[model samples]
Every structure is written in structure tokens, then in C-alpha cells.
Target: MKDVQTCLNAMTVDVEDFFHVSAFDKIIKPQDWDQYQPRVDGNTRRLLDIFSRHGVKSTFFVLGWVAERYPELIKEIHAQGHEIASHGYAHRRATEQDRQTFLADVRRSKNHLEDLLGEAVIGYRAPSFSIGYSNEWAFEVLAELGFSYSSSTYPVKHDLYGTPDWPRFAYQRAEQIMEIPIPTLKMMGRQIPIGGGGYFRLYPYALTHYLVNKYLDKEKQPYSFYFHPWEIDADQPRLNNASAKSRFRHYVNLQHTESKLDRLLQDFRWSTMKDVYGVNV
Candidate 1:
């Protein structure tokens, strides 16, 4: 194993409540989002505390809807020295909208976050890593809106979202926009996702650890890992009405995520995406 302690990786949190996840969209309408109790503030604060204990700074992609409801939470994240970036005004995927609609969604989010921080919020991640070949235009929209970089693409195959053929590392997408894909490992002539998400929860921590270390040692590049606040909240209300597959994906190994995350933090050196990728925002 490589001495991962010497290499800094990018740690990120998608700051949204469980109900905001796309898997529950069919069961939980956006209009009825208020009906569900909000657990993101507490869950995210829990992550912030964990990051603090490990002396790790992460980028938080704040959803505009959450910022609108919990302004103090957004401010608290910034106060604690984490980079604040946009997760769009709503959780709508870029693939589901037209170019104009997508533009409006991101613009509203960027403006909202900037209004909160009193500084430009130049980093963005599309909901669910939703940007792909079909919606490549989204990058132009992101650039048009003054974003410095986007960690919005995953270069692996998945039923939900993935641009398997996209660059696996940071590359410029537009004049001022850089697209940083989540880290993956090339194995058996295919890309295996080692970056965090449901895969972190699904696999044994030992396996995840090995893959991450392998990627770091072989790729010789900073790995970026992401997870949602809800992933650690095992007790968050369950939407049983949603499909079984969605529930399984959302709730699988929830009880163990926090502990696993703590271990992951202790095992790796971490910093914000801006610092790791040298993106000016």
C-alpha cells in the first residue's frame, strides 16, 4: 500500500435531505417536500464535526432548496471553513431539462449561494452526477454562469448516470470551466468506481480501502470522494412508498456509513477540491 497519508484527496458532501434524492422523486413530489421533516442540518453538522476531528476540509455542494429553508446551516458550513458550491436550485437532473431550463436552474442556484456567502460561488456539481453526452451543453451553461470548475461527471457505467467514455481526471471543458470526474480505477479493461457514494456503503470497508489505496498508488493523482449527508443518517424517516430498489439503494448499510467515513478520514489526507485541483473560485 502507498503512504496515502502524504497525498491529499478531495472530500465532498452533497448537502441535501434524504427526501431530496432522485430515487424518491416519484413518491415525494417537489411541491410536498415541506411535508417531510428536515434532517440535513443535523446530519451535515455531524459530517462537519467528523471532518473537524480529522483536520479535513471538504467542499459542500449546497442545494438551493435547502439553503432557502436552512440559511443558517449554509452559513455554518462556510463558517466552519468548508468551500460552498452549488447543487442547483432543485434536484432536477440536467438530462431531464432543456438547455434553457438547465441554465435557469443553475443560474438561480449560483445566485442564491453567492447571495448567502457575499462572494462568488464558482464550483458546481449537477444533481446525481447528471451531466453526460446527452447534456454536454450543460457545461456551456455552467461556464456561461461563471463557474470555475465542476465535479459533475462520473466516468463509470451505471443505470442512473455515468459517462463511461469521459475523461477520468480533471480537464478543461470551456474557457474557464474545468470538469473533474470522480475517481475510478481501470481494471480488466473496464472502469471500476472507487470514489465514494452508495458503493462505499455497499462494499466492505476493507475492499473500498484497498481499491482507494490502489487508485492512489497507481494513478498518482488526488482522488475525489463524495457522499450525501443522508447517507449517514440511518434513522432518517423511510419512504416505504418508494420502490424497493430505491429504498435498498438509499438505506443500505446506512448504520455503518458514519463509522466507515470516520475511518476513511483517518486513513487519508484531505482538502477542499479548490485546493486539491488548484481551481480559483
Candidate 2:
């Protein structure tokens, strides 16, 4: 039996280019996304190579726009033994879409992904972690569309998106699908966000290690951590006109991400979400 210390945590990548980030939504339009230099293909291939070096398999929540533009990339990700899941079409937030629009977006993405892989896409994640109290009904659409799980809720409070009052770990929602709120812990009566993304990039490696170990040893729960390919591309073009806060969040520690990820992969057991959660993909 595997030791609890080495139990697998879910490692995920939100596969979108540097320019597709939600931070620049006001300054950039989806129609103009193509105008930006595309770096996702090369950046994601770098992630696949890194995971390969460590013998780690990951779940890739691919944007439909990226998949349509690079079907071969999706094929190669699957061929390399990584799980392919939808990151929604258009990268629109759930709160920004009504039920019908959200449903159509997810269905379109899933259908295109399944067609490309010849297999069911069982997992999903909302862009910008936008499935919150206002859009709780989004769960019904996810379940109806045959997604078995979603990692869309971040329980920590954020200006853009969060359901801080929601369960901090994975829980079945609407009795149809599992809603895995990004892993967090209560400290000093405040929810501390530890489940990767900007938090992973912002926090020191020792603190991240301590936090993950606390979950493993005390809570006995494997954490779910996510990152985007753009996080590691330190040399990627910068959006100079973005707001100061958005610029910092998007660009902070870009040079340190890959090294931190290397340490993370080596220090813990990681696997695809389906395998870690026991959901067949």
C-alpha cells in the first residue's frame, strides 16, 4: 500500500496562452485574441516535457479556442498519457454567462474535445474561478452535460471570484457532480488560499511545503493545485497597459515558477485528477 505521505495530489494545468488571461479582459477583446502572439503551444509542450521528466501525469483543462486552433496539440497531450478536460470555450466566466450561454459554451468545448480524443471529457474548470454563489446553477449545466467533476470554486475570498463560505474541500453538489473547491485551510479565522495559481507563485516554497504537509498529515487530504503554462514563460510578452494589480498578479515570480514546480513534483506524489479522484475519464 502506498504511504499516506506519498498519496497522490491532483496536478492540473489551465491550457491558455499568455494573452488569454482574464486580467486583461477589459483591455483586450476575444475577437482580438488572435492578434496576440501565441505561446501556449510551445509553453504547454514545455510543461508536458517537464511532467515527462518527472514521470507525472496531469489533467489539462484546455480552452476550446486553443483546441480548435491546435488539434494536434490536444492529440499529443493525450498521446503522452495526460488527461484532457475542458476549460470552456471562449474563456468566459460562468457569472458572465447565463444558463443557456454557459451550457452552450461547455457543451461545445466538451463535444470538440471528445471528438478530438474519441473519449469522454469528464472534468471541467471555470475560467477565472467564476462559478460562485451568483452562478450556483452552473452545476446543473455541468452535470447535464456529462461532466463528472469540476474544480471551479476557490473557497478563499477574491475580488473577482470565490465562495469563501462553501466547503473547503471536494463535495458532491446537486447530487450529480463533485465540486472540488480549491484546497484551502482556515488560519486565524481566515481562509488561506494554498491551492496554486498566483498563490503558488506568490508563496515561498517552504510555506507551500508546510501547508501541503499539514493537509496530508493532519487532514489526510491530497491537495489540488493548478497553474497556467504562461506562469513559467518568463520571457513571454507583457501586457504593458494592464492595471498595476493585474500586471503584478500575472507577471510576479515568472522566472521562479519552473524551479518551484520542479521542487513540488519531486517532493510529492502527483497524478491526473481522474486518477487521484477515482473518476474514470
Candidate 3:
């Protein structure tokens, strides 16, 4: 086994509620998001408590909408010594927005987080890993807004968002901001995603453990994992109107996520994105 204390990886939380997910965007409009019960505060606090127990510090890529409504929650997260980053305003995908709109969205979120934390918020992860080849200009916008790095691209093939040709590891973009693609393992000439999110919940704990170990041993790089605040909240309201695929992806194994995360935390050392990648925020 790899020495847990020596292999520091990045743990990130996309601080959005169940309604904010892109999977439900077609069914649940952003303007109607207020109608949903505010469960993010409780769910996120639960995650914070879990991290506290395990002595882990993670980066929270918070939505501007959530931060606005739960400013105290944002303060509490920062007070706990977790890194505060942006998940853009309204959870709009970068691919869905024009360059100008994308810039405005990210800037709005970053400014809100910085205002709450009283520090620079430099890291960004696009909604749904939405920054792909067509919207590569998004990187220039991120750079122009003074973001130090972005974990906005998934270099694996996926139905919603991915650029299989993008670098599978952290690489500096020509636009000047560091682009940290979500971690994947190349096997049988394919990039298998082992980073986290629905994939983490879908796979059994033992399989995930083996795959993560394989990635670490073969790649010899930090494994960055991400999941949403609602992943652990099995009791959260379900959008029955969403597509069958979306519902399955969002709701599958909800009860097991927290336990799996606890194991993941104990299995490896974790830190903020800035710390793991040596990026200044």
C-alpha cells in the first residue's frame, strides 16, 4: 500500500444543491430554483463535519447562488480552513454560455466568494466540467479574470461534457491559467474516469479502491476527487420529471456516498487544489 500520509491528493466539493445540477436543467429552470427547499446548507455542513473528523482540508467550488442565500454557510466553510473557489453563478455550463456571459458568471461567483472569505478566490471548476474544445476561449476569460487555475475539463468521453483529446493531467494553458483536467486512467487505449462524482457512487467501494490504487501506482500523480453536496443526502427531494438517465445518475447509490467518502478520506492524504497543484490563490 502507498503511504497515505505521503501521497497528498486534492478533494473538492461542488457546493450546489440538487436542483442546480445540469442533469435537471431541462426540467428545473434556474429562476424556479428558489421553490426548492434549501438543503445545501445542511448537506454541506454534514460534509464539513465528515472532513473535520478525518482532519481533511478540501476546496469548495461554491455556486454564487448558494453563496448569496447562505452567506453564513460560506463563512462557516471558510472558517473551517477549507479553500473557497468558484463554481460559477447559477450553475450554468460554460458550453451553454457565450464568452462574455461565461466571464460574467465566473467573475460573479469568484467575487462573491472572495467577499465572504476576505481573500482572493482563484480556482474554478465549470458546471458539469463544461469547458471543452468548442469553448476553449473560456480559459482566456478565466485568465483575464485572474483565476490561477481551473479544474473545468474532463478528458474522457462522456455524453454530456468531455474532451477526450485534452490533457489528462495538469497542464498550463496557452491562455496563462493552469488547466487541471480531472484524473483518468488510460487502459485498453481508453481513458477510464476514476476521479469521482456519479462514477464514485456507481461503483462498489472495493472496485473504486482498486481502481484508485491502480491510478496512483501507475500514474504516480495526485488523485483529485470531486463530488456534490447532495451526493450524501439520500433524503433530498427527487426530480421525477427528469429523464430516466438523469435520475439514475443523480440518485443512484446516494446512501453509500458518505460512507465511501469516509473510506476514501482514511485511505489517502488530501488537501486543497491549490496545495496539491502548487498553484497560488
Candidate 4:
């Protein structure tokens, strides 16, 4: 986010517990999701309050179910001056299901957020950046569902998600719907992704700063940086079944998060995702 603040002048916030991920999907059922409410919600509130104090606004990709149960949380986020976008109803991966079901899920989540926010909801980012080559139709679904843009594709090669062949910078897809691919720096003819989550956790801050600056100097595009509220909450309960890989990815830089964030806020200008891509209101 510091890189984004330094380079793009904005950040995107995705709200979800560590367990809601695909690796732990087998363990946590929809009925059991509420068990994590107290921890996740409180931590999220802290994040919102922190951003509020900084006077930093962002585009919050909220889960629809969370919005339904915690409408006040949604209101609180908006009240503090942030843009609201959908993260689908239940955090399902787009490629895991068929096209029609995926489309329905998009529409369901979109409508749910628009109703709660009382504003036109135009953005939709798939859970885990799940929309890829297999689910390209997901974009068509988003357009049909009245969504104006999507940040669902990460333009890199990853085991979980990314579309290396897609355009790396923000651009209009087919002249109507927009595709805001995650920020990537082209190196030696290869697109290397250094934005958000794992990159934020594993890589050193200096490298991230250099990478974002490199992109700005060369590519001249806004670099997208994303983070979850739980990331900054050092005390968030660890998912018991999280594997070694998951554990490392989740916990690597917890202690340094707050400090890093402070540096980030100071280094660059930060705005909401909408503001970066020129999304109107």
C-alpha cells in the first residue's frame, strides 16, 4: 500500500478472515462463518478507524454476506469516507463453478451491496482474483449484471489466480466494461506481479518501493496495492488448519505491519481505487 501510496496514490481493501480462503474452504461452512464475527469485525473496525484517522479513503471490496449481517459496518466504512464494491456473496472462486452460477453469484452480490449502500455499485472483484482464462466469461456476466468495471484479474502467473496474457494496466475491455488488472512491472519481457498480500508480506519494503518506482518511471501506470484488515491486526486468531505455506504467507510481517503502514501513509498520496482509474462517483 505504501508503494501504491507512493506511486498510484490509492489502495484497495479486501475484508475477510484468514480462514475464508480456498485452502480452508473445506473446513468453514456458511453456517460456521459467523463464529469468526467478533474477531474479524472488531479488527476490521480498527482498520477503518485507522484509515479514518489518516484521512485516507479507499475502495473496500466487501463480502455481500458481511454487508447483509453488518450493514452498520458498511455504513461506518462509508461514513468514514470510502468507496464500496462487491466481493461476491460468499467468497467462492469464479473458476470452480459453471458460468451461469458464477454470473448469478456476481449479480446477487452486486445487488446486495447496491441495496445496502443506496448507491450505484459499479465494481466487482472476484474472491482471490479468481477470474482467469477459464472464467473469462465472468467479465461478460459482470457487464450484464450492471457492473461498470472489475478488478478480478491479476496479470501474472500464480497457482491460485492471474491472467498473464491480459493487459497489465487499467483499460476498457471491449469498450464498455473495464478490466483493472492488478499492477505488474514488465521485466525482460515478463510481467512480474509485486502488488498486495503475499508480496506485501514476503518482500522487503525497500524492494517494493523500488519496484513501484520502477514501474512509475517506465510503465507510467498506477500500481495497484491491496491489503486486508486482518493483516494489520496482529492478534487475529490463526486458523488452526492453515498449512505451513499458508501460515508463512499469513503471518510473516504481522509485527511490522503498523510501522510499515505508517511509512506508507507518509511516503505517498493515497486514494480510493475509483479515484485512481477515474471512476465517477
Candidate 5:
């Protein structure tokens, strides 16, 4: 295991509520999203407080819908010295939209975020890490619109999204866009997810801890960890009528998230993508 003390990992947050998760799309239509109670503001504030207490700054991939609803919240995130990146307008996956539609969404989100902060937003994270081999065009669009980098690929096999064959670390694409894939560890001839999200919650904390350090020692690369604001909000409203799998993935171990996060934050140095990678964004 590597000494985990000095490595500054890329800490990121997908700033969306439970209702905005892709797993609940079949049950909770986007049109009905407004009718549901909005819990993102409070949940995100709690995260900000935790980061402040730990003296850690992170990148917040803000959904355009959330930014539109809570403009001041976005301003506050920026004011607090956190990096703000686009998470697209609506939570739609790239594969779900055509090239024209995808470009529009990217432009709309980037423009909105840049307009709010009066500074260029150079980073983006696709909703649900939806950019894979089939949707490679998305990166070209991101570069064309002035985004310097994207953390929109999860290099693992999954039903929802994955580019299992993509480079598992940060690399520049043909379009001049830097791609920072979610962290994964190679073991037993396969890549296992050690990054964050449901995997972090589902696995024992000890295993996740070991895997993170192992990756650090072997690859000498800082991990890019991500989680949603809703992950730590244990008391947030639960979605009704959702499938058993979605409920299990979303609700399991919610109560344990904050404590585990505290340990991880203390164990690893954390910072925004731009700072850790020294990208001029």
C-alpha cells in the first residue's frame, strides 16, 4: 500500500438531487420533477459545510436545471472558492440525444454557468458518465465550445454506461479535450471500481481504503472520486414505486455515507480538478 498522506486526489460532487438520478427516470418523468419537493439546496449546503470544516475545496458539477432553480446557490459555490463545472441542462445521457441535440445541451449548460460566474467554465461532467465509444462526438463538441476537460467516462463494465476499453486515467483526446475517467483499480484481470458513488457505499470501507492506496502506489496517479449530494443526505425523501434495484442502489448505506466520507477526506489530500491537474481552465 502507498502512503496516502500527500497525494491530492480530485474530489468532485455531482450536484443533483435524488429525484434527478437516472435510475428513477422511468418512474419520475422530467415534466413532473418540479412537482416534487426540492431537496438539493439544503443537501448541497450540508456538503459545502462539511468541505469547509475539513478545509477542502472540490469541483461541483452543477446541473443546469439545478443552477436555473438555485442561481444564488451556484454563486455561493463559486464565492466559496469551489470550481463550478457543467453537468448538462437536463440529466439526459449523451447516447440518448443526437449530435445536434447534444451540442445544444452542452452549449446551453456551458453558457449558463459561464454567464452566472462571469468566468469561463472549462470543465464538464456528462450526466451519469454517459460518454462512451459510441458517443465520442460529445468530446469534440465539448472542445469546440471551449471546455478544457471532462470527467465524463467511467472505465468499467456497467448496464447503464461504461467505456471499459478507454484509458483509465487522464488523457487528452484527438479533439484537444482532456478526459478524466472515474478511478478504477485493475485486479484479477479486470477493472474494479474504487472511485465513489454506489460502489463506495456498497463495499466495506476497509476494502475501498485499501484499493485507493493500492492504485496510488501502483499507478502513482491521484484518484478522481465522485459522489452525489443526495448520497450523504440520509433523510432525503425516498422515491416511491421505483424498482427494487434502483431503491437498493440509491438508499442502501445512506446513513453511513457521511462518516465514511470524513475518513476518506482525512486520509487523502483533496482538491479541485483544475488545481490537482494544473489545467488552465
Candidate 6:
């Protein structure tokens, strides 16, 4: 709540259906997305309405596959004056493949999304925070793909993704790509998750709420917060029967999310990440 009201300056929205999550790796294939239920359309539209009400603009990191299939959504996001970005052609994480594979994914996805939106896509984020330590070199691929900025690194350590060694606040020119690592606040001598993804969902909103303003008071850096539309839709069916830990991570705070979001809107002066970081290029 405090982050949105007292500290938040930018938001990043990943446009993907629920099933595209890596936790469903075994059962889901790209071709199987058609069978995906309810689609993200309704949920995302609600999200847009909320942002609209807040007069907030965010960068929508859309999947090329999703954008290709749902150009209207991409168009709508752009029509509303937010930036359109690539979240890869399919939803595969960059860590799922080697450099060659990751390059291909970035190249193809960029081409596809730019074609659909009829504008150059300037930013990219991996499916999950897929460009952690080992694959930090993937920045070269993104720059080569004609991207000028990226938001794929998470400045924390985690089983699925994060790069603790990476800069916590937004920094740029590493790999010649302006990198906007996801929002995190320093805690107990280490970085903590407070921006988006499972961390936002799993933790108590009060805790996240306090941490954001606490960091802002101490550090003076604008905070970044993110959430998916699927998260706001507490009833969005569990996309897969994920592991106990993953399930807890993904679904822990679904019930309290909407109220928490309402609280955030009331509290924060939120906007998109690029404006916060000054990455207008």
C-alpha cells in the first residue's frame, strides 16, 4: 500500500495466460494454449480499468504469441499510451535453453511483437526472471535484437530465478542494455522481494506495504511494484497442479489481493517503471 502511494513510480505488466508459467513445463506445450481457460482478456481488462482509474500508465511486457493472437490487447495497451514490450515469442524462460536458443527466442519474439504493434519494441523481460547469474551474458543477445532496455533480472536469490549479485535498484549499460531489475528493498543485510510475482502474492500486504515506504524513507529511490491480472482474479482456476511449494507461492494471497490492491491504489502515486528510471529511449 505504501509503495503504491508513497513510493511507487512505475509498473510493469506481463501479458501472459496463466498456464504459460514454467511450473507447468511437463504438461503444457505452446500448441496447447488454445485449450487454456477463460483467457487473460477479462482479467487484464479489469487491470487496465484499475490503472485507468488511477491515471497510471505501465509498460506491458507482452508475449509475442499472445500479442500475435490478441493484437487488440496490444493495440489497446498502446492506445492507452503505455509502452509495448516483448516477453518472448512463447513463454519459455531464457534459462531453459543455451545462448543460441535464448538468442533465437529473443530475436523471433521481438520481430513478431514489433510487426503486430507496428512499432519498435524497446524492452524485454524473460518469461520468469530467467536471466540470472549464469545467463547474465544473455544481455548481449537482447541488445543485438535491437532492444535498448531490459527488466529481466531479479536482485535476489531464489530457486526458480533471481540474481543476488545484480544491482538492487535500476541500473543500466551492463551488456549495453539498460537493465531495470525488478523492485526490491534491502533487508537484514540482503535484498528482499517487494515488487511483483510470487513474492507480492505470498507475503502479507502490510509487510510489503511497510517495506516500500521504509526503503523510500531511507534510500530515496522510487520503488517499483507489479502484479498480474490473473492475481487480481482470485478465482482464476489454478492453471496446473503445481508442487506444494510452488502452489503455496503462487496462490497464497489470492484471497486478499483485490482488497490489498484497492489499498495500494488509495495509498500510492504509481506509474510506469521507465519514467521512474528515466529510460525514455
lDDT of 2 at 39: 92
Worst 10 residues of 3 by lDDT: 1-10
lDDT of 4 by residue, 1-281 (tens): 32433455658888776667665676777678767744557777987777777778888998877777788888888877888988888888988879888877777878887877788888888988998878677888888887888888898888788788888878888737888888888899888787777687677877777887777777767767788877787777777676777677778888777667766665666788888888753
**Candidate 3, superposed: residue stretches over 4 Å from native:** 1-5
TM-score-wise, the better of 4 and 5 is 5
> What is candidate 2's lDDT per residue for 54-111, written digit by digit as tens?
9999999999999999999999999999999999999998999999999999999999
Candidate 6, residue 191: the lDDT equals 83
Steric collisions counted per model: 0, 0, 0, 2, 0, 6
> Where in model 4 is the C-alpha error above 4 Å?
1-8
Error of 3 at 3 (Å): 6.2
Clashing pairs in 4: 9-271, 10-271
lDDT of 4: 0.78
Residue-by-residue lDDT tens digits, candidate 1, 1-281: 65566788999988899988998988888899888789999998888889889888999999999998889999999999999999998899889999999999899988988898999998999998999989888888898899999999999988889999889989986556999999999999999988888999999999998998898888889999999999999999878888999999999999999999998998888999999999985
Model 1: residues with Cα > 4 Å off, grouped in runs: none
Runs of candidate 2 exceeding 4 Å displacement: 1-4
The local distance difference test score of each candidate is 0.91, 0.91, 0.91, 0.78, 0.91, 0.77
TM-score of each candidate? 0.98, 0.97, 0.98, 0.91, 0.98, 0.91
Per-residue alpha-carbon lDDT of model 6 for 1-281, expressed as tens digits?
A: 23434455677788887778776666678788788774688877887888788787888888777777777887888889887888887788888789898888778878887777687888888888788767767888888887888888887878778888868766776577888878777778978788866777777878767876787777787776666767777777774556776667667778787777776666767766666677655
> Regarding lDDT, does 2 or 4 come out ahead?
2
Q: Cα lDDT for residue 118, model 1?
A: 97
Tens digits of lDDT, candidate 5, 1-281: 55667788999999998889998988988899999888899989999999998999999999999998899999999999999999999999988999999999988988989899999999999988999888788988999999999999998999999999989999988999899999989999999988899999998889888999999988889888999999998898877689999999899999999999998888889999999888885
